[model samples]
Target: MGTGVVVRALSGRYELLDPLGQGGMGVVYRAHDRELERTVAVKVLPAQMLRDADFLARFRRKARAAAGLSHPNIATVFDIGEDAQDGEPIPYLVMELVEGETLGDLLRRTPLTPAQAGQIATAVLEALEHSHGRGIVHRDIKPADIMVRFADFADFADSQARVKVMDFGIAKLMSETATRLTSTGMRIGTPAYMSPEQADGRPADARTDLYSTGCVPYEMLTGRPPFTADSPAAMRFQHIYSRPPG
Candidate 1:
């Protein structure tokens, strides 16, 4: 919350180095762990948001959903806590700092070969399968959210590319006992990669993740999303009704 060069310690363990990126819910920083002497990604939710009961509930739910899983293809959540900053408490999550570029960044430069695309899809599916088996449905699956490590591209036995899926901020817990996260008729997820049921504001399950994952390969091969529109409203309509281009 200060100048670019300002260094701050969070929870007295994570030493903030520089800001990485920001999303709707929080700001992400590339930080160092004084305890472990390693680099990590710290997603910090503003202290004010923590004061709101509804937002705080959703934020914790998201973190808990992500923290439940352990897989090579998923970013690891190391720690979570609050840090006092100028008399305010800043809640933060310490996550594995993934190396290499995002799928979106790679695609922007060049399209992937069918074989390469297939490899990436398989890795992502493995992650989905593990999460789905635990009743967690990733509501968002897009190029930007997928990290591909070129260094591991030759490790075909493990995976041609080390693909790690990030950002489960809107993932839905698909069990009857789970809390009803979204309000009635409220929509969540990115329109460009949204599953049909998600776009229609219907209940999503493992199948929802399958449909969204299908979109990844389509874009990898065609160098574009299956459908596009001028506005998010139009995209939602297309996701619900329009067939993808052949």
Candidate 2:
């Protein structure tokens, strides 16, 4: 909390190597598991926000829920641990180091044929189905939250592509407190993909995920998000009332 950084080995086992990506809560890193002798992704949550006993309890519960998932299309959560940094406990989750490009990055660089889009969509649905069955609703679903790997981009096929849906129970933790999270510089739900209920600050259910997932494929095929507006506020309005472009 004092330093505004998580720069040391977690629990003296997971060594932070390179930062992979970052979001509102914390940064994810490509790390080495000295104990297990393997490569893994470590997501370190901000230290200051976790000092409260109630908040830390909630984090452990949600992290456990996210780690319980098992599916081919969902990245695996291997472990959760904490490290002391200047007398503060920094929590971190060890996850599978998925080797792939984010779907959002892919779309920016390459065009997806209908076949490729369909394959990716099916994989996402399957992942969602498994999570929804477990009563975990991914409140935030967007292109960036999905990772896709292919045997080779030049000769893409259904069998060659692998899809993994990420940050499942993570968003659900932020769902009930969108205003507070936003105040802390955390993005709640992505505008273009959020359902009407989410845009209106309502609790999300399985249908909310379906609504957001529908937008992913729609964007994949159309070369743009189905609905676009000048600002995030306007985008939320469109999500609530307007139909996306066909």
Which numbered prediction scores highest in lDDT against the true structure? 2
Provide the global lDDT of candidate 2 against the true structure: 0.83
All models, RMSD in angstroms: 4.9, 2.5
Candidate 1 lDDT, tens digit per residue, 225-245?
999999888998999989998
Ten contiguous residues with the weakest lDDT in model 1: 173-182
- What is the alpha-carbon lDDT of model 1 when measured against the actual structure? 0.76
Give the per-residue lDDT of model 2 (tens digit) for 1-246: 322334567888887888888766667889889988999998887654563456666767887998999999999888887777667788778899999999999999999989999999999999999999999888788998899988887876535778998888877664444445556565555588889998888877999999999999999999999888889899989998898876
Instruction: In angstroms, give how far residue 233 of model 1 lies from its true place.
Output: 0.3
Q: How close is candidate 1 to the true structure, as a TM-score?
A: 0.84
Write down the TM-score of every candidate: 0.84, 0.91
User: After superposing candidate 1, which stretches have Cα over 4 Å from the reference?
Assistant: 2-6, 46-48, 152-159, 169-189
